[model samples]
Target: MSDIIAHTGSAFRLTLRRAGRSLLARIGCDCPLCGARVAGARLCAGCESDIAGSMADPAVPRCPRCALRLRHGHCAACLAGAPPFSRCVAAFDYEPPADILVHMLKSGLRLSMAPVLAGMMARACARQGLVLPAGAVLVPVPAGRASLRRRGMNPAAEIARALAGELDIPLARAVLARRRETPRQATLDRRARRRAAQGLYVCREPLAGRHAVLVDDVMTTGSTVRAAAQALIAGGAQDVTVLVAA
Candidate 1:
């Protein structure tokens, strides 16, 4: 009986969310990044183009594992030892107008920007020719308690929800859980960030033989996603791929 109630509640919430999105599409709104008026979209065409142009240049050298930009050779960290994830795909570099989208979603609490970011992420996957194997599932990195209390929503989970809809994939919303809250990664050095993220996440679901597409809003040092991927692998996922809004 409890399971039936939970499933019904989830269905009700999903229906309400879809209705809200449809209403927004009909009314139209201004672009969140810029002040430009947009019709039936959250981002203006100019802003979208700027974001598309900000994607990592295919010609530039980068780490095959983490997608970190490189001057000539692959990233030293990835070279010394590859990250747990198979590959990382970012919609755009974390800069300028693109950064604004993340800020709006996270700090500004503009939940409507999620689908816009997800659409771009889906396009980024296409640009990279990324193909998910059968039984691939989207799993969002869970937010810390402090962030959830402040923002009232996890930006990564919101993006993952929209991404799942865009890609027509299943979303394992509660598969990964945060073990404990630590200092913000932005406040720590690279090595410290990795240490802080160690064993920070745990997988609650069995993912044996399934491909996991990890989703996040932005990845700086990649410590968070790396930790999450390790947890997924430990949970028996075949492999993990990272997709971020940047």
Candidate 2:
């Protein structure tokens, strides 16, 4: 009884806070980063410039497969063999301000930032010529039921929802799902991670030759995205494109 009451109280407080923030957003608001009044913008000019600078790597080529910054034309690993995905794009490097912002969304449940970040990512993809194919759908990598129960929402789904709007694509939330609980990827090494992620995802709907853009907050080893692409392909998706904010 006490636990239930505490949960309800916490939820109420979160709701109240979100409502207050929404009200401020409607009238006027400070930038999410520096607290300077930006009126209609999510970020102040200076912060926006900083965020752009963090991802400004044009001279260095990136791997077409995983979007990793490359030295020679193609990354050695990619040259050896490509993953299941056709292409990948990342908006920012997993560093400093980007890291902080992702942490805020994933851990703190600051969903208000999703649209801003997704817009930036979509713009970045355009600048790099990573356009989505016509009729492609934005499919967020699904979170397990256990994870959803704990976080109350899926950060990847939130980002994908916003990104679909920005890209003018349809969002497919129930196309894929986790088949069963799996160990955390962070608790494993590269080889172990790949093995652990294998066959973890199941396609819940028939894609039937539809193009899929897998959305996630971050792409580290690319293992998660690869597994997801496999599931999508098995479900009759024509191909998978990887999209991530960091």
Best by TM-score: 1
List TM-scores for all candidates, in order.
Answer: 0.86, 0.81
Q: Which 10 consecutive positions of candidate 1 have the poorest summed lDDT? A: 53-62
Q: Which candidate is the best by lDDT?
A: 1
lDDT, residue 141, candidate 1 = 98
Question: Candidate 1: lDDT over CA atoms?
Answer: 0.87
Which residue runs does candidate 2 get wrong by more than 4 Å?
1-27, 39-41, 71-77
Candidate lDDT scores, in order, read 0.87, 0.81
The TM-score between candidate 2 and the true structure equals 0.81
> lDDT score, residue 53, model 2?
61
